[model samples]
Target: MAAGGRGSGRPAKKKSPTKGTGGNKRRGLEGRGATPPAHLRHWHKDKARTERVEREERTGGKTSAARPQTRTRRSEDAPEYIGGRNPVLEALRAGVPAAAMYVALRIDNDDRVKEAVRLAAERGIALLEVGREKLDRLTEGGIHQGVALQIPAYEYAHPDDLVSIAQEAGEVPLIVALDSVTDPRNLGAIARSATAFGAHGLLVPSRRSAGVTGGAWKTSAGTLATLTVARASNLTSALREYREAGLFVVGLDGEGSVDLEKANLLDGPLVIVVGSEGKGLSRLVAESCDLVVRIPMHAAAESLNAGVAAGIALYEVARHRRR
Candidate 1:
């Protein structure tokens, strides 16, 4: 009491256990070790890393740091080609349908360009003309031969007609519908995937749908030749007709009530509707479905690309159909 302050109730509170723990040599060195100083932490970290890498190498295991990563640009399903008289003529003669065609009006009308125009019109493709600069952008500075045609986006078949036709032939009809998929590439990729998976045909709206075009054909890598494509006046009406014909129509949505795997897809003919790249199935289309199904995914990803999602759905449907 005499040594301590008279008014203090007790000795001043000692520092916290952790405060001077670092300074206590006996406690710090108890395990035949000393705490690493701040400057040496990096050294210890690097040493441990080096040791782990060496051990992995000796054991024939790869370390995370040892693998190099790479990125690759996949070959597009449809790629634009630029060439002059002979090439364009060859493409047309080879049965490549040009979606849109352009001619240089200023040039003296030549028979080759005239024939190009004739072929395009015969095939019901649009023809237009622009300044050389615009043609340059379209042809990427390649020989345009004063004529270029945007290739047809996709091959189409009438959904109703396809179903009836398939039935008459004693084969189950498989049709895929798109809600609002606008990207020509996606449309082409989906077509390619559908054809590859043995789907009968593809259906899209007359409006807001990517039509058969060169870009899509390129994306399909000539798969369009094997597929029948159909354009619907109104998709809702078409879906109704499908249901009336005893076909099961399923819509793919992230919040679907039925898991795709458990859905009874093998029972009969079916139509799989995939939403647009940006917005999924429109309200009317979603409401028209006999069932709404979803592919289970982890919490991390909100959704998948429309083309990829369509491919997966088609694969699942094909798998069941084959069984």
Candidate 2:
């Protein structure tokens, strides 16, 4: 008879109704009787739906088709391109892999563009017809010459690779480096000489240096295709790496202690650093050299162009190494 007897326990509690039903079937909750406020429930669902739509948009949802494309909208995995007919042609001849090529539709069977298209076809590189505006944007103000090649950026060889390339050819390694060489023509000419002389390779800085462009390729007469040219983040760092790899660093300066021909370049591995035509090597680059050698000249010339200086120095090194 006690009130606490098991049989007398209070009747099972009725299931609680979910809150905020408000006589609306669509807004009803299961039987917890704890529904949120009506306004809050509507707001929560709307907010979640908005977030889901926003996420889809950010991820390039189906609705992205209506968005206008941007000029700078490059493909996510498109290879870097180097434009101009000569560069493209040279790249093709050199057996470089081109991911794709773009020809100006306006060109309409131009011989040069046609040749580029043929080359791309032969190499199995895809060819696309793009508007001139796209070509201009792709080249970034470069001389596209009605041809743009989507080849990967130049793959530079390590300075030490010079040694093996030379030794394997049964010759001493003769490498060239440029200090603040600004003229693409000079860079190209140096490449030409380096290739012609059977020198090992050439190295230049990644910044403040002229790249292998159309003008430079023409200057090289396509010799760049055969030569192994390496680019360094900086000349000093490249020189240091060269020195560490058992190569002597020789710098060219007009007012140096030793003559160019007298330098002992043939004794071992050598890398010659030639400065810019106007402003010779920077103070740091000059100090990094093991020795500063000068090319003897009469008072007739104030200085030599960087290309000429590099050619002269490389010739001497090659000649000495041969002897």
What TM-score fits each model? 0.57, 0.64
- Clash pairs, model 2 backbone: 17-33, 18-33, 19-35
Per-residue lDDT, model 2, residue 322, is: 64
Count backbone overlaps in model 2. 3
Query: Candidate 2: deviation at residue 100, Å?
Result: 2.1
Cα lDDT tens digits, model 1, 1-323, are 55556566667656665555555886756686678886689988888886774444233343345454364221223334434655455556546766567777696677777776777778787878777765665665766767665552233567777786677778787888888888878887898788887777889898877776545655665676567788998999999999999888999988789988899964468899999754678899999999999879998988888889989988888788778
**CA lDDT of every candidate:** 0.73, 0.74
Query: Model 1: runs farther than 4 Å from truth?
Result: 1-95, 98-157
Clashes of each: 18, 3
Q: Once superposed on the true structure, which residue ranges of model 2 sit more than 4 Å away at CA?
A: 1-80, 108-112, 182-185, 205-225, 231-241, 297-300
| Span of 10 residues, lowest total lDDT, candidate 1 | 71-80
Q: What is the lDDT of residue 314 in candidate 2?
A: 70
Question: Which lDDT value does model 2 have at 289?
Answer: 90
What tens digits encode model 2's per-residue C-alpha lDDT throughout 173-269? 6788888888878988898888877777888787888766544655675677678887777778878877887788889998788998888754577
